[model samples]
Target: MEVTLLFVSFFTLLFIGVPIAITLGISSLLYLVTSGIPLTIVPQKMYSGLDSFVLLCVPGFILAGNLMNSGNITDQIIRLSNAMVGHIRGGLGLANVAGSMLFGGVSGTAVADTASIGSVMIPGMKKNGYDGPFAAAVTAASSTIGPIIPPSLPMIIVGTLTGLSVGQLFLAGAVPGLLLGFGMMITVYILAIKRNYPKGERVSFKELLSAFKSSSGAISLTFLILFGIVGGFFTPTEASIVASFYAVVLGLYVYKGLKFKDLPKILLSTAITSASLMVLVGLANVFGWILTSEKIPQMISNLILGISENPIIVLLIINLLLLFVGTFMETIAALIILFPTLLGVAVGVGVDPIHFGIIAVLNLMIGLSTPPVGVCLFVASSISGISMEKVSKAIIPFIICNLIVLMLVTYIPELSLWLPKFFF
Candidate 1:
C-alpha cells in the first residue's frame, strides 16, 4: 500500500505537469506519511544525497559551458564544422551533426547543445533552402551526442551514483558518442539526397586551415579535460574547475567574446541551473531511499532475472525499458531513480559497469529527442518555428539511425570498453 501510494502520487503529479523534482518529493512524502515514518527523514535524506564531493563537478562544468557559450564559442564550432563538411550533399545538415559533436565536448549537456547550435543552424539551414522541420529534426537528434561525449554531465552523475571511475566512464562513452554523431550524419546525407538539398561551394585548403586555427582554442579544452582526468593531473571535479578557468581566459582575453560586465548574468544563470539539478538529485535520492526500503530494486532484479538469465535477452529488455522511460523522464532524474537498480541487473549478467553506464546514458540521451516530453525536440521546434508534429515526423529517420548505433553499443561491449582500456 505504501509503494502503491508512492507510485500513484508520482505518476499523478507527473501527469498533472508538476515539476519532476517536486513530484519526486511529494511522492516520497506521501509514502513516508502512510508508512508512519517521521517527516524529518526528507531533509536528512536530501542532505545526505547532496553531501558528495564529486557533485561539485556539476556546477563547475555548467559554469564552464556557459562561459564558453558566452564567449561565442558556438559560432567558431559551427564555422569549423561548415568548412569541413559544407561541400557535401546535405552539407549544412552534416555540419549540424559535426557542430554538435564539437560543441558537446564543451557544453556536456544536450539542452545546451540544442539551444546554442539550433539557434544558429536551424535558421541558417532554413535560409539556405532546408525545410524547417528537417533542420529542427537534425538539431534535436544530434544534440543527444552532447552527453555521450567526454566532459559529460550525465557521466558525472553515473560516477557519483555507483562510485565507478569517472575518467573511465568518460572514456567509455567516447567511441559510442562518435558513433551516434556519424550515424546522424549518414541519415542526414541520405535524407538530403532524397530531398535534393543544396550544398555550399567547397572551400580552399587555406580557408579550412583558417577555420581550424580559429577554433583550435575551443577544441583544445576538450583534450585538456580528457588528458587531465586520464593522466591524473586532476580529478574530474578539479578538471571542471580547470575547464572553467580556461574558458574564462579564452572568453575574456583570447576570444574577446566575454566581458567583465557579462560575469554577473552568467554566474546567475549557472547558479539557477546548478541549483535545480542539485534539488532534483536530492529529491531523487529520497525517492530511491523509499524504493530500497520497500526492496523494490531486489524485486525488479528478481523479476528481470526470472524472465531469463540470458545476458543478451536481459540486456535487450533493459534497453527497451530505458528507452521507454527516457521518452517521459528527465535524464538526470531518470538516472538517479533507475540507474542503481538497473546496474544491479546488468552486473548480475556479467556486464561491465563502465560499459553498462555508456549503454544506459545513450538510451536516455536518445529519449531527450523523443516525443511526448522530449525537451530537445520542443526547444528545436521553438527555434525553427515549426509544429512538434512536423519535427516528430521528420526526426523518425534520425531516431532509427540512433537506435542502430544504440544496438551496436549494446551488443559489443568492446566498443565502449576499448578506449578506457587503451587509455587507462
Candidate 2:
C-alpha cells in the first residue's frame, strides 16, 4: 500500500507536468502521510541532502559555464573547430560536433551545450545549406558529450552519492566521451557524403594557428579542472571554483569577451540553476528515503536477479530499462531515484562502482538527446525551428553512434577505466 501510493502519486504528478522538484516533495509527503512516518523526517532529510561540501561545485561550474557563454567564446570555438576540419566535406557539420566536444569541457551540461552551440550552429548550418533537422540532430546528439568529459556536473553528483573519487570518475569518462565525439563526427562524415552537405574552404596554417592560440585559454580550463583534481592540488569543489575564476580572468581581461558588468547577471543565473538542482536533490533524497525504508532496493535486486544472474545479461537489462526511462525522465531525477538501487545490484555482481558510474552517466546523457524530456533535444530543435519528431528522426544515426560507444564503454571497461588507472 505504501509503495503503491508512493509510485502512483509520483507518476501522477510527473505525467501531469508538475516541476520535478515539487513532484518529488509531494510524493514523499504522500508516502509519509499514508505510511504513518513522522513528517519531520522530510525537513530533516531535505536539509541533510542539500548540505554537502561537494555540492558547492554545482554553482561554481554553472557560473563558469554561464560566464563562458556570455564571454563570446562560442564563436572562437566554432572558428577553431572549422579551422581544424572546415575543409572536409560537411565541415560545418563536423565543426558542430567538434565545438560541442570542446564546449563540453566547460558547460558540464548538455542543454547548455545545445543552447550555446545550437544558437550559433543551427542557423549557420541552415544558412550553409544543411537540412534544419539534420543540423539540429547533430547539435543535440553531440551535446550529450558535455557531462561525459571531465568537470562533469553529473559525475560530481554521482561522486557525492556513491563516495567514489570525483577524480577517478572524471578520468573514467575521458575515453568514452572522446569516443562519443569521434563517433558522431564519423556519422557526420557519412551523413555529409550521403546528404551532399556543403563544405568550407581549407583554412591556411596562419589562420589555424591564430584560432588555436585564441581558444587555448578556454580549452585550458578543462585541463585545470582535471589536473587540479588528479594532480592532488585541490578537491573537485575547489577545482570548480578555480574553473570559474579562470574563466572570469580570461573573459574579462585576455579575451575581452566579457565585462565586469556581466558578473551580476552571470551569478544570478548560476544561483537559479544551481538552486533548482539543489532543491531537486533535497526532495529526491526524501523520496529515496521512502523507497529505502521499504527495502525497495532489495526488492528490485531480487526482481532483476530473478531474470538473470549473468552480469552481462543483467547489465544489458539495466541498460535497456534505463534507456526507456530516460526518454521521459530528467537525468538528475533519474539518477537520484534509481542509482542506489542499481548500484547495489551491480556491486554485488562484482562490477566496479567507478566503471558503473561512467556507464550510468553516459546512459542518462543519451536520454538528454532523446525526446519528450530530453532537454538538449528540445533546445536544439527549438533553435533549428524543427519539430522534435523531425529532429528525432534526423538524430537516429548519431544516436546509433552514441549507442555503439556506450556498448564499448559497457563491455570493455578499459575504455572508461584506463585513464583513471593510468593517471592514478
Candidate 3:
C-alpha cells in the first residue's frame, strides 16, 4: 500500500506539472507519513545526499558553462562549423550538428546547447531556405551531444552516484558522442538530398583558417578541461574551476564579448541553476532512501533477472526501460533514481559499470529530443516558431539515427571503453 501510494502520488504530481524537485519531495513525504517513518529522515537523507565532495563539481561546471555562453562562444562555434560544413548538401543542418558537437565540449548540458545554438541556427537555417521544422529538429537532436561529450554535467552526476572515475566516464562517452554526432550529420545529409535543401558555397581554405583562428580560444577550453582531467593535472572539480576562470578571461579580455555588467546577470543565472539542481539532488536522495527502505532496488533487480539472466537480453530490456523513462523524466532526476538500481543489474550480468554509464546517459540524452516531455524539442520548436507536432514529425529521422548509434554503443563495449582504457 505504501509503495502504491508513493508511485501514485509521484506520477500524479509529475503529470500535473509540479516541479520535479517538489514532486519528489512530496511523494517521499507521503510515503514516510503512511509508513509511520519519522519525518526527520527527510532532512538527514537530503543532507547526506548533498554532502559529497564530488558534487562540488556541479556548480563549478554550471558557472563555467554560463560564463562561456555569456562570452559569445556560440557565434564563434557556429562560424567555425559553418566554414567547415556549409558546402555540404544540407549545409545548415550539417553545421547545426557540427556546432552542437563543438559547443558540447563547453556547455556540457543539452538545454544550453539547444538554446544557444538554436537561437542562432534555427533562424539562420530558416532564412537560408531550410524548413522551420527541419531546422528545429536538427537543433534539438544534435544538442543531445552536449552531455555525451566531455565536461558533461550528466557524467559528473554518474560519477557521484557510482564513485566511478569522472575522467574515465568522460573518456568513455567521447567515442559514443562522436558517433551520435556523425550519425546525425549523415541523416541530415540524406534528408537534405531527399528534400533538396540548399547548400552554401564552399569557403576558401583561407576563410576556413580564419574561422578556426577566431574560434580557437573557445575550442581550446575543451582541450584544457579534458587534458587537465585525464593528464592528472587536476581533478574534475578543479578542472571546473579552471574552466570557469578561463571562460572569464576569454569573455572579458580575449573575446571582449562579456562585459563587467554581464557578470551579475551570469552569476545570478548560475546560482539559480545550481540551487535548483542541488535541491533536486537532495530531494531525489530522499526519494531514493524511501526506495531503499522498501527494498525497491532489490525487487527491481530480481524482477529483471527473473525475466532473463543473459547479459544481452538484460541490457536490451534495460535500454528499452531507460528510453521510455527518458521521454518523461528529467535526465538527472532519472539518473539519481534509476541508475544505482540498474547498475547492480548490469554488473550482475557482467557488464562493466563504466560502459553501462555511457549507455544510460546516451539513452537519456536522446530522450531530451523525444516528444511529450522532451525539453529540447520544446525549446527548439519555440525558437523555430513551429508547432510541436511539426518538430516531432521532423525529428523522427534524427531520432532513428540516434537510436542506431545507441545500438552500436550498446553491443560494442569498445566504443565506450576503448578511450578510457587507452588513456588511463
Candidate 4:
C-alpha cells in the first residue's frame, strides 16, 4: 500500500507537468501522511540533504560557467577551432564538434556548451555551406561531453551519494570524455564526406599563432581544472572552487568582457540553479527514506534475484530501467531517486560503484539529448531557431556516434577507470 501510493502520487505529479522539485516534495509529503511517519522527519531530511560540503561546488561551477558564457570566451574558442580545423574537407562541420569539445572542458555543463558554442558555430557552419540541421545536430550531440568531463556537477553528486572520492571519479571521466569527443569528430568526418560540405581555406601559420595567443587565457581555465585534479593538487570539490575563481579572473582580466557589475547577477543565477538542485536532493532523500523505511530495496532485490541470479542479466535490466526513467525525469532527480537503490544491488553483486557510476551517468546524459523533454535538445533547438523535428533528424548520426562511445565506456571499464587508478 505504501509503495503503491508512493509510485502513484509521484507519477501523477510528473505526468501532469508539475515542476520536478515540487513533484518530489509533494509526493514525499503524501507518503509521510499515509505511511504515518512523523512529519518532523521531513524537515530533518531536507535540511540534512542540502547540508553537505561537497554540494558547495555546484553553485561555484555554475556561476563560473555563466560568467564564461558572457565573457566572450565563445568567440575566442570558435576562432581557435577555426584555425585548427577550418581548412579540412569538412572543416567547419568538424570545427563545430571540436569547438564544443573544447568548450565542454571549460563550462562543465552541456547546455552552456551548446548555447555558448552552438550560437556562434551554427551560424558560421551554415555560412560555410554546412546544412543547418546538421550544424544543430552536431552541436547538440557533441555538447553531451561536458558532464562526462571533470569538474562535472553530476560527478560531484555521484561522489556525494555513493561515498566515492570525487577526485577519483574526475580522473576516471577524463579518458572516456576524450573518447566521446573523438567519436563525435569521426562521425562528423564521415557525414562531411557524404554530404560534400564545403572545405575551408587553410589557416596560415601566422593566423594560427595569433589565434592561439589570443585565446591563451580561456584555454588556461581548462588546464587549471584538469591539472588541479590530475596533478593531485586538489579534490574535485576544491578544484571546482578554484575553477570558479579562475573563470572570474579570465573574464574580468584576460577577456575584459565581463564587467564587475556582472558578478552580482552571475552569483544570483548560480544560487538559483544551485538551490533548485538542492531542493530536488532534499525531496529525493525524503522519498528514498519512505522506500528504505519499507525495506523496498531488499524486497526488490529479492524479487530480481528470484527472477534471474545472473549478474550480467541483472545489470542489463538495471540499465534499461534507468534508460526508461531518463527519458522523462531530470538527470539529478533520477540519480537521487534511483541510484541509492541501484547502488545497493550493484554492490551486492560485486560491481564496482565507480565503474557503474560512469556507465550510469553516460547512459542518462544521452537522455539530455533525447526527445519529449530533453533539456539539452530543447536548448539547442531554441538557440538555432531550428524546429525540434529538424534537430532530431540531424541528431540521428551523432546519436549513433554517442551510443558507440557509450558502449565502449560501458563494456571497457578500463577506458573509464584507467586514469583514476594510474594517477590516484
| C-alpha TM-score for every candidate | 0.99, 0.98, 0.99, 0.94
Candidate 3 C-alpha lDDT tens digits along 173-202: 889989999999999999999999999999
**What would the per-residue lDDT of candidate 4 be over residues 359-399, giving only the tens digit for each residue?**
78877878788766677788888888889999988888877
Question: Better model by TM-score, 1 or 4?
Answer: 1
Model 1 lDDT per residue over 292-340, tens place: 9889989989999999999999999999999999998889999988999
Task: Candidate 1: list runs displaced more than 4 Å.
Answer: none
Rank order (by lDDT, best first): 1, 3, 2, 4
lDDT of 4 at 350: 72
lDDT (C-alpha, whole model) for all candidates: 0.95, 0.90, 0.94, 0.82
Model 2 CA deviation exceeding 4 Å by range: none
Number of the candidate with higher lDDT, 1 or 3: 1
Which one wins by TM-score: 2 or 3? 3
Give per-residue CA lDDT, model 2, range 1-424, as digits (tens): 8789888988999899898899998888888998788899988998988888888988899999999998889989999999999999999999999999999998899999999999999999999999999999999999999999888988988888878899999999988999999999999999999989999999899999999999999998999999889999999889888989999998999889899998898898899998899999999899888888889878889999999888898789889878887787788888888997898888888788899998899999998887666778888878888999999899989888989888988999888888889999
- On lDDT, the candidate that comes out on top is 1
Error of 4 at 405 (Å): 1.4
List clashing residue pairs in candidate 3: none
